[model samples]
Target: MPILPRVALLLAACLAPATLAAAPDRAPQDVSGRVLRATGTTTSGEGIPGIAVSNGIDIVRTDAQGRYRLAAGAGQTVFVVKPPGYRFAEAADGLPAFWRTVPADRTAGAMAIDFTLVAEDRPAVSAPEVLLFTDSQVKSARDIDYYRRDIVEPIIGRHPAALGVTLGDLVDDQVQLYAALNAVTVRLGVPWFHVPGNHDVDPGSTGDAASLATWGATYGPDTYAVEEGDAAFVFLDDVVVRPGGTGYVGGLREDQFRFLGNYLAQLPRERLLVLGMHIPVFDTGGRETFRGADRARLFALLKDRPKVLLLSGHSHVQQHYWHAAKDGWQGAAPLHEYNVGAACGAFWSGAPDAQGIPDATMADGTPNGYAVLSLRSGGGYALAYHPARLAAGTQAFTPAMALHAPRVLRRGAYPAWGVFANVFMGDAGTRVEYRVDGGDWLPMRRVERADPRLLVENVADDVATALRGFDRSPEAVPPTHLWRGALPTDLAVGEHRVEVRAFDRWQGEAVAATTYSLQEAGP
Candidate 1:
């Protein structure tokens, strides 16, 4: 198949899915045009010494004069490693002013890039809350308008935390919409960071080298790191375009690994490490979409860190996976990877509601929304899901979920109707219980399967006389947080209420209810 057709099929099928060794002692490589001179300065124009800067493969620090040189390749990005007690200069839209991209054409010339750092007011900060948005795949003017009115407005419902991140796919293929998306993000009133998704790549490019040129121009470095408080956050570009733009693979380049290794070594052993990327590091349902070697290398690097959280966004569905000895993680406890849900749920499909926002519920029945991650000042962290529509103003206390069950069943029928609930933020340890007609609380089985609610929606759209929505939502994918239980059919005839309550591992709870009727068969 042609590249475009293949891309479309991939989208229809699955929506789909560094470096740096030896910063301290090894001497910087001397290449004629490969070197870049980077200076760290404060807003007052004073030289800020001791700031670490990287070229995605090597790590170096500014000297007493606040100047350092990095050996960089063409199309590489050199970003400042944000130090504690200071922040980076931010644009009006709150994107950190921290990186500069080396031109792709100049494979061997030296360039100068300067970074300005602003001192933090609090001197010390241990706990910080970050807003995480993934796969905002907004396409066309209408999508942009919908995003602003729906996703953006609810996210900044109140003054959010000081920092935020968009894991990728800020705009659907049109890179031109980046500015418009940025305009909405600025409303959140915090510095936001980004990663590159497969959609963000420049398909015109021949290979991975130049595929991110446009993205680099719009979002600074495709790979870089920054510090907020006790946490060190690394944003990486893991979408590698194929040789002829056929498709992209999910893995890290040698340069990114080198950079990551070098950068992590400089941070305190106890500091929290948060790695945000577009594609997850693990294989999903035997898809083998992600590179195992890259994941293994990453595990080796973070094996010593007691606290680590990996955040990925390419998968439209929300899931929580803990990597243990069986999954290549060598840590004492399981490594937590939160496959955050998408902002453009089901690619903005399904029927629109009274608010004119598409019911973009994800294929797994997860409502389209963003996430809030709270990092404790000490070390631990907790994450919660915020639905864009339902919990718009009240998510802090309300847990939201999609409950799927038959509305009516014959009293003599076997208990074959399964009640499926997709708790947007539930994990393996989340306690989910369902009761029929205020009966005893019965535990629901945690099942990894397609959400029945979405399956019905897919069937509805597939056979509809006239299309009733923006687009038909895609086929259901296996959900990570779905719970199921067969409803009791041996009941007296009449209407009965079914209620489900899910308590997340963090003690956050949400309740949902529906009514089912039991009827006696007529002779």
Candidate 2:
């Protein structure tokens, strides 16, 4: 076990309230405020006991009558911590129906919010395919049209995935568009869950309590859980509102950590614990994007659960991270975090195509698209990336890398013209290799730099005389998935095939091929 930081140990001790003590029966608190009687029942109206409910602060359990009362202030959201074997009803656009926001009109007094859960008879899904989309950020009808044409159209009624999940940033600062997003997602014909991103916050809220008011009204609780087959998926609201609604920060509240501890305590260790959120728990750019103490508390809870996967999406970049003991992970195996790419690649910016959709390749050269995760019977998971558009004259599934090199090169000038491969999901440890004319494979060095192709793509709009469709793709940022190597300078004046292959830590390999010709020195 790793040594606990002094602050984490102190926070843990302070967070151990009497409410968490084991008791056969406890009476409701005698606090003065808006009292909410939260009751849980089956679809047939039978009371279901021992369900936990929260108002984002205090956690209370139902009595033998399947009811629990908690205090709720104005703009507070009261949500149920959904139990196993029961499924909450979903909203029209696939948001879980597990929470309710107290109206501001009711300044004082008591109200009753009852939750009805239907018994779910899920099949023994030994291997289930799950759809994952991130950073859709739909803001207008045109954006919706783009999504419908490119994403929804190709995915509906075709995929065999059991369910789908969006890793936050559902809309671009317009909570109202969630309905439109939901309408589009509903056609997928599967249960969908969401996480609250920074952009999803209500700007009018002065504090964190009301930041998710609109989100809760539309997508149920910001924090909840769902169990499918042998996997338990937990969604946490990691975006805390900045004071005065100026911005947001990546941190977990004490109550959220409390909820994780209380909920996970009831679950068996054998279940695969899949944690999903908007901001990543891992560090980014030497910054403490996530609170270290909060992360330590969570790691302490899941230290024994060997099968775990962390998912997040707020940076609009796809990359993988492994957390070992130094990062506070105590498991025998390192934990994996998959920071998925955006569906609205580069915020729907770039050159337009024949269909009027933007190229929108990400800074890392990952095309605007989604991912598919396959879960096996023995708590194993594999992920595959899918691109939105295929290259010219090709119909097969898109490859991960898009090689950036000129189609023709002058002899002896190959040293200046290096081949750069943009491996969409690669990290520093990923193995990248390239070969010329199907010869010996040579290693390509990983480079933490902006994607050269994106730089060139952005230059197209910068140098154009008139504005084009949509907007120009933003300037390229330093990418974590790029590799480069100089080509051989002695090739003959003929066509040469360059083949590149990349292998991720999960044992997934992707390959791409292109041909270029070497020309004579003089004309």
Candidate 3:
């Protein structure tokens, strides 16, 4: 199958564990030559026809001889979208080198850009699973090791996803640490893509475009895309730098809009369009995180057909939003946006575990982790989130939600308390129900409150006389994915097992369990 089209942008965050190991060499640069051959594979390497190449704005296919001519403005990049059944060699540092920079000085008669690819042993995939990670934001070398051990290590011989993407804030203002982090991620084998975050912007940069110099040099084009059998994935650099490079806003630059307008027009409506970025398209902190007009413009450009899914990071907590007309989304159905959990949960805060890694749960109660995106043939999709560390080895993590409840309650007393089910992947329409001791299933009410489980840590931190951990657990914030159902007061006088279940649109039904007890009312 031929790899299809669309474009994308940047990668993940950071955390810390007990050990601090340095990462490998920096990623490889362009296809060897500064002076690239554009026409004669006989010399240009552009001789292969039907290959897709782009300048982040215009996309063109190679001529009969695999030769292509693309117009890339000064400072733009020329990269080839990895077609199915093919692979690029990893640079010295293990990062796949697939792009070349178009020099700032373009007045010369002709410019050279190199793109090289080799065949892979794997067969073409009709459908692919992609891992989506974000906000590693590690500040020190210790955080790098934490990210490596806590996240990457378990995933190394484990994940078989086609490729991976990091939504942004790969590090916390520590730009120099990018190489070390890349060394950690390269172990996954699949090519990883990244975009800049507010923390990723070069502080020394004079403006928005300049802020990404370090990022672009490390990860290629701030905005680009790739095609697969089931969808077209696009990455966009949406963080706009403020004047004097002091602050930033979440939005897309004009050049991206031009690129999107041109690229989307050519996209087949039958294919899914997955846009990956660091900052979310919605407002944050009571302010417009993204420019309203730009969002409106971007939305208007995306026609109703073909399923469109947006993946983002920046808010450490996990969430989902369906943009409607009021939000300037006038599509056939409300637009679905999944605000993914941070890889460096709560900036790697919380009490250290036995392994010396922080609890790192997001303030909204989601444990720091990453997402698995399953893109099926014919434009259908499904997704699941994996908390960094799971119970024991080999057994893949299950249980769509985690259950929490009282240990023992007075028998025959007012059932004031209830069980809380934090349905990790739940949404507004997701049906979550609970039952006790083989009784009837009762629907759990969706609650926008802190998860009672995490509250214990928050309260402990507030009342403690000394530091609880290297960093305190995140202060609990009301979460949109939590559910509650009061435990019956009249239940039998012994321990009772409670069961909870939820329906995931794609993965089918998922179940979980916990226990609570009832004691005699007497003191």
The TM-scores, one per candidate, come to: 0.84, 0.83, 0.89
Clashes of each: 13, 0, 33
Instruction: Estimate the TM-score for candidate 2.
Output: 0.83
Note the Cα lDDT for every prediction shown.
Answer: 0.76, 0.74, 0.77
Put down candidate 2 lDDT per residue, 292-402, tens digits, no spaces. 888888888888888999999988778888999889988888999998888898888888899999887887777888888887766778788888887787311245778
Model 2 weakest 10-residue run by lDDT: 29-38
Worst 10 residues of 3 by lDDT: 10-19
TM-score-better candidate, 1 vs 3: 3
Which candidate tops TM-score?
3
User: 378-496, model 3: which lDDT tens digit per residue?
Assistant: 88888899999754532112446667799898888788899988878888888999999999999999999999878988998999999878889988998889999999879778899
Ranking by lDDT: 3, 1, 2
RMSD of 2: 6.8
Candidate 1 lDDT by residue in tens digits, 445-478: 9997888877887888888999869787878887
- Sorted on TM-score, best first, the list reads 3, 1, 2
TM-score of 1: 0.84
